[model samples]
Target: MALDPAPPMLEPPAGDEVARLRRMAQRQWAARRDLERRLHDGAALRVSALTLRLGLLSHLHPDEARDLRTAVEGIQDELHLVLQELRDIAGRLYPPLLDEAGLGPALREAAGRCAVPVRIDAPDERFGPDVEGAVYFAVLGCLSDGAATPVEVVIRRQADVLRVLVSGVDACDAGTIHDGVRLLGGTVALGESPAGDALITVRIPCV
Candidate 1:
């Protein structure tokens, strides 16, 4: 019997391709940071100021027509909501906590907003911006997968490698997470826990 032709071997990315990917990632991060800053300093501030002014107007018109006072209060409430929404969008673009505190605290803040329970165990030590950003978003993406099960996340640094393991979240889009991590010279693996829950492992060089 004739032997089947050997399968082609997969080649690692060339040095130039890796460099290109890094450049793209850097540009993306920079853009996100810039957009966040604009939202924080520009739209959010303006809306907040307007809300305050409307409050003051409402007070000034207390003796005026009741409908006028009600209109001002309504506008103030809408503006307050707008300001909050702007802040939320800016945070989602690039969290200020991620830059100020580091990965552990940032993740904790994100977990607090999740519908299901989330447990995070990460060191307070800092890593490079790229490393921390990639890991933060990767974990966040998994948590946002809308799974009903509680999630457990653990992060550890060994020598130059940073390892993250997340369990109890299945149905996460592996391709999206893989692409984000791969851009930072990391690998992502999806498996099943002993109890059959989803397990995701990520490893990246922090140096």
Candidate 2:
């Protein structure tokens, strides 16, 4: 009775595999920052200058050409809209607040944009950019989209580990959160809160 050939032994991930993931994460962060800089310094600046020029042209136009003034003003309005959209895109790509104010302020700003109320409990202290970015995006990803249910977010640092807890959100994509956290040598778990809300817990090591 040879019991089913004893299931094959499972092997842990190789060191090279972990290194590759770290490299990939670094590249992604660099690319996002570069793109955000270009949008802010290049495209956004150019659009803003064009809008100002159009405004000046409208003002300098003679009263005889009322049609031309109206056209210039219309163009200025469109340019303004474009500038706003560019800034929004840049913010989404990589928020400057994260770099300047650390994780707490950045998360607060994001929470302000949500339709439902979000309560946050995090320290104002700074952490490595990779650690902060991973935790910020993880929490942001778990936020309820268009749901009226309020969310509760908590962040704490213990010795060398950074822990994050999110509750009151339902239907979260745990796989996506897991992938993001795993790249930082972290773990993510899905559970239920005392109030019966879906809870997500994340732990990442940081120096």
What lDDT does the true structure give each of the candidates?
0.82, 0.81
Clashing pairs in 1: none
What digit string (tens of lDDT, one per residue) describes model 1 on residues 1-207?
999996675775587677777667767776787788888888888888887887787777777768878898788888888878887887878888887899889999999999999999999898866777788898888888776888999999999899988888874655667877898678888888787987888888766
For each candidate, how many residue pairs have backbone atoms clashing (under 3 Å)?
Answer: 0, 0
* lDDT over C-alpha atoms for residue 64 of model 1: 79
Winning candidate number (lDDT): 1
Among residues 3 or more apart in sequence or in different chains, the pairs in candidate 2 whose N, CA or C atoms overlap within 3 Å are: none
lDDT of prediction 1: 0.82
**Model 1: how far residue 33 lies from native, Å:** 1.9
lDDT of 2 by residue, 66-146 (tens): 888889878888998898888788777778788779888999999998988999999988886677777788778877355
Lowest lDDT 10-residue stretch of candidate 2? 4-13
